[model samples]
Target: MQILIAGASGFLGRRLVSHLRDAGHDVTPLVRRPPRPGEVRWDPTSGVLDATVVAAADAVINLAGAGVADKRWTSQYKQVLLDSRVDTTRTIARAIAAAPDKPRVLLNSSAVGYYGDTGDHAVDETAPAGEGFLADVCKVWEAATGPAEDAGTRVVLLRTGFPLDKDGGLLKPLYLQFRLFAGGPMGSGRQYLPWISLPDWLDAVGFLLERDVSGPVNLTGPEPVTNAEFSAALGRVLHRPSLLPVPGFALRAAVGEFGGEALASQRVLPGVLVREGFTFAHQTVEEALQQAVSSITQ
Candidate 1:
């Protein structure tokens, strides 16, 4: 299949591009700069995208969004987060709508933060949108794909969780902290942390690309563990002691409003993926951490 992906330079995106290419799919990346070979130039900020480019792809995936945890939640950066996602999604969706021959599907990125702090309650794709800044951002972010959906495209809102790998995502820094003996749960350590192994995350994306599914799909593991459980799993995998814990107030002081959210509980479940018969390579956090740690050592 011919796939065109925005945000192809990002950590997950870079891996996805390679994964798809290795699987014999022709993947073209949408770049901000001038077009290179096998690349399409698009500027979401300027709303510049060729409809022909959109029409030619068999599928389109838009993972373009500002990192929610990259900066403190100041009003300015908050707007930046909102605009970065909404604008890019709107541009891609509009392009797809304008195309004479539309792509079969659009897998747009979202986050499990859509459910806000779920406490211990589990949530699937059918859950209502929750409150808080990250939740609000995810709401608008997913809604930005309206144009393409209105144009009859099969839109899949990827409500992703923490994709754990040794190189990037949530595990990298945590790995370092563990090695230094500073790693432990944040806040009360009771908040649930929804996670998926990196390999599983990549494979799930491929599964969604071909599956006859639409709407919000939780790209998370089958069994979600609490932050404390996550810390224990990582510690066990690394032969480190998981004793020190970061207090909630200290987290809030360090990263502003996002700090509270860092410890938010989201026991998200992959309802669609499971019902569709997608299998996970790592069913538990410990197994996931083992793979991630092994990758780092090698």
Candidate 2:
């Protein structure tokens, strides 16, 4: 398979490129810089991409976006978050639509924030859009894939959860905090945290590439855990004590607008993945945390 991916330099994108290439798939990355061998150049901010490039690929996976937690969500940075995702997705969708021969599928990125703060309730793909800044961003982000989907291209909206790995995602800072014996749950710790192991996330993307499925797919683990449970599991895995609990106000003070979201409850389930018979190697939060920790030491 020939796969063209936007945001190929990101944490997940970099790993995905290696994973696909290891599986013997031809992967071409979309870059903002000058083109290198086996790479495509496109300015997504300006919606500049050759339709021929879209036509040449068997599949296109877009993971492009400004990092939500990268900086304080000022009104300016908030717009950056929206534009980065919506503009990039719209660019690819338009290119795919304009192509004489469209790619077989478009796997665009989204987030579980589409469900807002679900509290104790569990949600699947069928859930309606939620309210809030992140929710609004996700709605527009997913809708940006309209052109490709309307053009009869199979479009998959990857409503990803928190991916657990030693190198990145929400785990990095927490790992450091635990190492310094200052780690604990955030806020009430009762809020559900939808998380998936890095390996399962990679495998699920590969699975969807071949499966005859479309629309919103939640890339979360089968069993969602509360923030407290997750913190405890991480502490156990690292042989550290999980006694401290950060209040919501402190979190908000620490990370600004992203803190509210950091404590947001989302009991998201991988309904599509499970219904389609996708298997997870790590079913529990503890298991996932152990694997993540061991991966670092090994």
Candidate 2 worst ten-residue window by lDDT = 289-298
Top-lDDT candidate index = 2
Worst 10-residue lDDT window for candidate 1 reads: 289-298
Candidate 1 wrongly placed segments (more than 4 Å): none
User: What's the TM-score of every candidate structure?
Assistant: 0.99, 0.99
The alpha-carbon lDDT assigned to residue 33 of candidate 2 equals 97
lDDT of 1 by residue, 43-158 (tens): 99988889998999999999998888888999999999999999999999999999999999999999999999899999999999999998999999899899999999999999
- Model 2 segments beyond 4 Å from truth? none
- lDDT by residue for model 2 over 1-298, one digit each (tens)? 9999999999899999999999999999999999999999999989999999889999999999999989999999999999999999999999999999999999999999999999999999999998889999999999999999999999999999999998899899899999999999999999999999999999999999999999999999999999999999999999999999999999899889899988889999999999999999999988888888896757
> All predictions: root-mean-square deviation over Cα?
0.8, 0.7
C-alpha lDDT of residue 266 in model 1: 96
- Positional deviation of residue 77's Cα in model 1 after best superposition, in angstroms: 0.7
Query: What is the TM-score of candidate 1?
Result: 0.99
Candidate 1, residue 285: CA error in Å? Answer: 0.6
Clashes of 1: 0
